[model samples]
Target: MKSSILLLAAAATLSAQIDRIEGERIRPHVKFLSSDLLEGRGVGARGGQLAAEYIAAQFAAAGLKPGGENGTYFQRVPLRSVEVEPGGALTATAGGKSISFKWLDDFVATSHTQEPTGQFDAEAVFVGHGIVAPEYQWDDYKGVDVKGKVVVLFTNEPPSTDANFFKGKALTYYGRWTYKYEEAARQGAVAAIIIHTTPTASYGWQVLRANGRAQPQVRRAAGEPALTLAAWVTTDAGAQLLGLAGRTVEEMLQASDKRGFKAMPLGKIHVAGKFNFKLQDIETVNVAGVVPGSDPKLSSEAVLYSAHWDHLGIGQPVNGDPIYNGAIDNATGCGLLIEMARAWSSMEPKPLRSGWFVAVAAEESGLLGSRYFADHPMLPAAQIAANLNFDSFSPYGRVKDAIMTGADRTSFFALVQSVAERHRLSIKPDGHPESGGYYRSDHYSFARVGIPAFSINMGGEYEGRPSDYAAQKAKEEGSTYHQPSDEYKASWDFSGMEQFARFGLALGIEIGNLEKIPPRVDAK
Candidate 1:
């Protein structure tokens, strides 16, 4: 009798949420967003502006109220684009000998000072991995004072097979280059340089050279600590830098893996650099809209659903294609967000708490828009029930499972599991956790601020394909991810996206109606 009642309840809930979501309704949005005319939806570009306006219009059509600043559906995000100008130089001096490395060939760097030109000369300190995790009982900076020095470090943390140590091979935020720079600044370092290798960074030298040479960042707030220069040097450059101190990069790597390794200063080695910067100030927008709650007492509390709408604008062409049309990278996620907003707004009696749909900008530029929103939120961080993010989705038809990375780290796990089961979708573990995906997405911006957040994506288990289909699809997806070839196909499947959208909508409503907000579940 209990089993029968549970089945009936699940069916009822499914019927209510599925009433408004149409798989076909998502295609038009994806089609237009990924069109060549949008120029890849580049942040701070004219194409990015069009994308924001379209998202706001979709929200207005869905009966959502303006949830941005001053009764508008757009939240302004100020940004600065920085690129190293030509004729700049980086040199390492040791024992009356100086070695000057060529830009983009040996190293790449940009200034965070927002100044047109600057120079710094300081002694070099090698801090292995540059990580300081109290939980892991590891401190590379122990007994070392690196203030006003140039801290050179590797890209990844120590190797570990035990899950208790650094999450066991799965990269943590501490392993990310962004964290390395942040920690360096906090330690009063004038500049931070990461030694990059394809194995440690999970990418090739070309990727580092492409991104490090130019980048965009959120305008720094006053009083925030920052390094004057952030850089990445090739493995060869790193070897030469360390060789000047009579050490090998191989020896340093081996020592960095051991526990209790301490930082060391390079003997008589110093770095000096003066780089001119081409700086431009640009403004972007994060389109946000809200559906008010039905319950008066709970209406103040809120839940946020987010998907980034930015991609690499224009870059060097691959096979003569310059546009990085991010169809699957995020256009699909934005389409799902729009359709979900319409469905949530159509409910007769809305959830107890308000539902916010935010199509953030500049995610491809290191989650700048989402970071800005998290720092300057429309609602209090404490009152936020949860944040559910959508990034990339497979366009290869329906699947038997869904992947919700980091959901297990929150109190919403039980509800998420129940909803997936009710919707006949299995939950899958992260396939490539070593990639540090959790720290790479916009959801991490919210998670870092004490809010429960995770991204929703479809798993590889296609419902009706041959056994080897998953592997084949994985290879195919990798080739198109972040490429111009990721253009939208009218024949592409939206069934899986539509199914997960329903599941997300139902789960969010359940959370909103709960007696208390969801909280983070500390890892054991």
Candidate 2:
């Protein structure tokens, strides 16, 4: 009874401290970060570099030791920016007959290497959905050799109407473009192109066109040669190619949804394309800091917290405003991370395990910063306990709940739930699983390497209003998600953000004080 009372009192004190930090320190930092001068913290821009420097300075001011490799607080990530020359074309030929498709209107291609020039010519094979997962008992590459050939894949997994194939209504990693590219490389395919549709991809061709115009993030595969080419074709273009081979796109998609689908030939079609682009060698930094633990023996173990600081830099001006200020997209997250660090640093009894805070860059382009860190970690991957990632937080007032993106896959959810409940908050599952947001963020890089990592977003539920109404409002607010208008509003609420920070800090502290590392759940 006495111990319980002490625990209650300690909880109250921690809550009070969290409120103080959020109101006085965190709010101020967030305001500055989201200010107009940062120019939306765009990747590879002056504003982006300024944001990195500011984050590093904040880490230093916090008295946290530099956690970057080689006694530095910043890890320089090499990036190659490639701009596809205008008028690029893709042509298909068979039996001396040829057809050509224009860029954007018909096709798009980007290299995943530092090389500015690359070329490849191979037979084209339609590989249906191009997924091979034992769990799903599906193999789209069955009895097919795509070496030195272009493998065409349909976007998204099997139809939800089909119960036996994939998770009908849900998207598995197999459906993601990243997974398709990796699977093709593993299958020795020289090139791969995905057929895109608005409903299937959940975005318009404009999104692909925008991304294709930017330089892609890629890590050298050492001795392994980079895939010769990876590209995307419009739905109409894919259909045209299929028609030339005497097959229909609908037939291909239908076949792909079946259990025993096989790679089908597009009747010996030839594709040729030349990529011309100027490659700019640029370096971005990942800011890192570490807090040493109190226990001499267990201090070696580490927990990592990550948030991306880069956003869409200055872009097409909106009403003469050029900066794409990504306030909620990540400045809020960075603020939360800094505030948590301050709280942990001020603790009377330091944690038993160390903590590392990473503010990554180029997350807007791809998961470049975190991918670089994962590939070249300051510490061994095996010594890291887990990774907690924050992308954006709640700004529409406090909620009675929190949402865990990859909750069921890891034990970290339990700790998060416990902490949430302690603060009179409920833990909620992802409301939009179809978005596949779990695989879209930095935590995914860590999870790929067997690290139990998860990302948390503000819960969908909003109290003091109808739950349905609040959910609608949240979705509407998120629509301004990646736009220049994501600037911090005066009416924004920080109470929910404070609660989220407290939950994250408590979980980190608990993990730090534990004797055994938090193991990945069986499913993870």
Candidate 3:
């Protein structure tokens, strides 16, 4: 009975500390970060450097110690930017007839091997989804030797209803476009071409076009297996190429969906490409700060909070707006990180473990900053207790539920549920698992390295709004996401973002005070 009373008192005190976090405090940060002057916070750009400096200033004001290298708040991440020059050609030939594809209109490609000038002429082979999963007993490259061939494949994996097979309807990492390219390189393929379809890629062809034209920043260490050409073609172009060999896109799609699918080489069909690339080496920094714990021994272990501070910098104009401000996409998340750092710094008797805040860079460039941190950590991987990530937050009003994707995959789920119950916020499951929400954000980088991590956000169920409010907001977001129209508005309600930060604070406190670190249930 005495212990129960003490626990109640501690909970009340902790609640009071988190109550200090407010929407008014978070408003100014979001407005400034998403302002036009920031220039979309492009990675390795001047605006990106300014964003990192602003975050470091906020961390200094909160009285937190620097958690980065050399007694400073900056950890440098090295990258190489690859830009494919125009005037390149991709052609498919069969039976003495050839069809040349237009550069950006019909196809886009680059050589990941870092070659300044390269060309490949090889027979085309359809390698079904390009996946090789031993657990599911699946291997698309089973019988055929695809070495020195141009491998053509789809983006996602085969459909499944059983959870044991490729995680059922939820898309696994194996289904990502990155995985497709990496697997092709591993199989000794000279080049890879992905057929873009709305249902498979989860976005329209416009998204691919935008990403393809942009300079891609990559982290390739020495001696990595890479392809001479990684390419994507529209459904129309794919059908045209396949038709040359007497096959339809519909027929190939149906055959690939079944198990034991074999690699089919197109008879007498040859794909060839010639390209020139401009490469530049660049550096970006991850801003990191820490609040030391009160307990001496336990302070060695740490709890991490992360947010990515990047977006699609300057890009093709939409509605005469060329700046991708990324207001709700990530400015809200960084705003919450600043406020949470302030709150954690002011705790009277600090939690048992240290708390670290990191605003990563190059998230829009494929989670590069977070991946670098995971590879080169401040503390040993085993000493880090857990990671609580904040990505894009809703600007709508408060929500009655929260979505903590991938939390159920760790032992922290019980504590997460209890914290949600305390705040009158119900725990909600992922609504669009097929989009692979778990693998899309910065948290996945840590999770990939055996660290327990998950992103925090308000669920679709809002308070004091119409029943269809969530659906309406989702529809509105689809049009603005990654578009220049994603700008900040003073009229937005930041109460939902505030609520998410407070919940994160409470959950982080619980994890920090635990007797032992939470184990990752899915750890191999």
Model 3: CA > 4 A from native: 1-5, 214-216, 476-478
RMSD of each: 2.9, 3.3, 1.7
> What is the per-residue lDDT of model 2 for residues 1-524, given as tens digits with 9 covering 90 to 100?
99999989977766655554563466776777888888878677778888888888888888888887678788988887766666566788888778898876677777655566667667889898888888777788888888888888887787664545465565767788878888888888877889887767877675565454555465465666455667888889888888778877778888887777889878989777667666776788899999898889788878888999988776545557767788988898999888887777777667788888999988877788998898888888877888889888867777777777775577666677776677677777676655567778888888877777888677766768686867577577655566667788777788778778877887777777778876676433
Reference-based TM-score of each model: 0.91, 0.87, 0.96
* lDDT (0 to 1) per candidate: 0.86, 0.77, 0.88
Clashes found in each candidate (C-alpha, N, C closer than 3 A): 0, 2, 0
Of candidates 2 and 1, the better by TM-score: 1
Write one digit per residue (lDDT tens) for candidate 1, span 403-429.
Answer: 898788888888899888978889989
On residues 111-143, what C-alpha lDDT tens digit does candidate 3 reach at each position? 788868779999999998999999999999999
**Order of candidate numbers by TM-score, starting with the best:** 3, 1, 2
For this target, which candidate reaches the highest lDDT against the unseen true structure?
3
lDDT of 2 at 52: 85
